[model samples]
Target chain A: MKTEEMITRLAEGLRPVRRMPSPPVMLALWTLLAASVIGLAALVFGTREGLDRPMTRFDMMHSLAALLTALLAGLAAFELALPDRDRRWAWLPLPAIGLWLGTMGVGCVGELVRLGAEGIRFHVSWPCLQFIIGLGLPMAGLMLWLTRHAAWIRPGPVAGFGALSAAAFASIGLTLVHPTFGPLMVLAWHGVAVLAVTGLAALFGPRLAWRVPA
Target chain B: MSHAQPLCLMLAPGQVARDARDLRWSTLMAAAQEGDGAAYATLLAECLPFLRAICRARLRDAAEAEDAVQDALLTLHRVRHTYDPARPFRPWVAAIAERRALDRLRRRGRQVARETLLDDAAELGAEGEAEERLAACQLREAVGELPQAQRTALQLTKIEQLSLQEASARSGMSIGALKVATHRALHSLRRRLTGGAP
Candidate 1:
């Protein structure tokens, strides 16, 4: 009859959806989104005619973008399934982002070799490199920033490594392919990350040491 | 003005109440097991008003009362596994509301205060306090539709509060006959009351 009583009735389902989140998860997703958008841009360049000469370079960049989108959205969805306290384990994504970004240097060297041998004397041209930097290093930096919340976190080997593996793979395959992902696919991918990150919170977030027990 | 006024019931009126009356708690429990949100919502809606009143009377303030209700409902779902189907549902619910209210006060580390001594038993008025303002009109209107014996038996048992033996003795009927009359009276009353809408 009263408003509070009404709220309590409605709250049964809403209780589990409280927006508790993890640190590593935030980094992982941020890295993924930043990289995905950049990857999408490179995809635009590859599709456009002006950037036709160094095609493989753009293709590889495109592939990395798709991968980041998949990984970030997946992380988001997966983490969301975890319990409330465990939601913050999302911070684990930060270090994983770092580990992932570190791998990009390796991929870029190979691309740099491919570009140099072609005798193409292009100026340090903007969109191409900026796109690559956006996907590759900036994502890593964003992930690292996300993980800065780690001081309050309890050590969790499984989540930490899982997030790291996700980020590392996101970074390792940075220059791997130039596949085209539709916007819907990108959204679904983003959905999955949001779901994972939030799901992980729903499932395991409650156990995170930083979560004040309800 | 009379038609526009809210029903002043513990539950939502008309279709919602009818829907709830049609509800079978057993069905809800089954649907909830399969993760049905709608069924769960219905179940929660049905019990909430009574649970709210109990909580409000038992606890110190509005916030604490609602919080205790939430905790109790969670516990209800948690322990739904243990609810025995054969027993009446109310006492079990009342026991849970009582326990959760007590638990909430204890958690707050405050002494449980009471405006009235018997918290759960508080009433809008003492029993029969409003009897004069409304009485025989309702009973006669509803009971008029019953068979003569059934109507007489019901009046003796309910309004007169006579025991079955006393009712039978007073009415010059066998005990078995009196029981049958009461059952038929209730069936007739239910049909008349509920059938009017449909």
Candidate 2:
């Protein structure tokens, strides 16, 4: 079509669009939704037994890091969705990710010190995969819905952040309920889940997120 | 700091005019988001010169530059909601135009490469043609793997250089089906060759 005709057609078809919320607002919205969904799922499934056991410092640190990573990654996704935003904003989640990894590393070393080679024993936990990914489905879906319109330019990275956020949030809820495993098991299974979710979302999100001109 | 403040105050005439234009465009865009057709039309019309300049600067071919401008306009229309009223508009539009121009450039470059390589292959005839031959072999292998319908459509339309009507009659598929099959075949070939990188 001629440019003039396209412009006229576009103008004729114009309709009021709901402005996307700012990144911080979107982050808050995702956080609330994620918390509610994950928390409800945990409540429904019931938390890990040992409710009276004292929480360790590592447990607290790990939870905080996951939460921070989710929030930062969510924010990055929203920020990167806009066409005018700097691409460097993609680095927003890096520090939190580093912290999360560091906490796992520290926990692994602490386990090794306390229990020798037995601490790092690898165990295949089917429930870990099921809970993380299964619970993560809704969170990822919600994120994709929220960013559907905004992610025209950077859909892959945005969806990646969305998946990361969802997976991390799912991990947090899973930790509260699922029986604690060895640090190595947590690292292996949980890391795999996160990678799988991120990779899949990144692979398919562009196709799902936007309708580009032919 | 005081000295620099005075220097900063002395804005150039061109900068002042550009800033004013940006503010006007932003206001129009904000209005356009509210479904103001006149505002949207005027905004797009006003943006033509700048978009043309950007496209022309980046794309040497007139037709391609024009196409890029149209693409930019379409993109701007599609993502109008992404424009925050608080931000300046020029950067947003410029970014879209620049991205579209670069896309056109990349596409043009790829087309040139393919055409040149094909021409080189034909010219080489009996001489060393290892690289082009390998590429052709890979493409042929990929095409061989396509589904029967898509392969027939591609062969009839692309390899045989038949018109869609002729290809449709020969393949016993409607024109629309042929078009879709041919498109999918090309897409599949591209994905196979590029390893699914978009």
Index of the highest-TM-score prediction: 2
lDDT of 2 at A19: 71
Q: Candidate 2: fnat, from 0 to 1? A: 0.61
The i-RMS of candidate 1 is 15.6
CA shift of B162, model 1, Å: 56
Q: Candidate 2 on A155-180: residue-level lDDT in tens?
A: 78888999999999999998888987
Which 10 residues in a row give candidate 1 chain B its minimum summed lDDT? B1-10
Candidate 1 C-alpha lDDT tens digits along A1-214: 3444543444345322222244355545655665575566446544443334554543454345545543643464344322222355456345434433333444445545766545433233233233333343333333333332221222233333334333334333333333323222222332244334334433443244223212
Every candidate's chain B TM-score: 0.41, 0.60
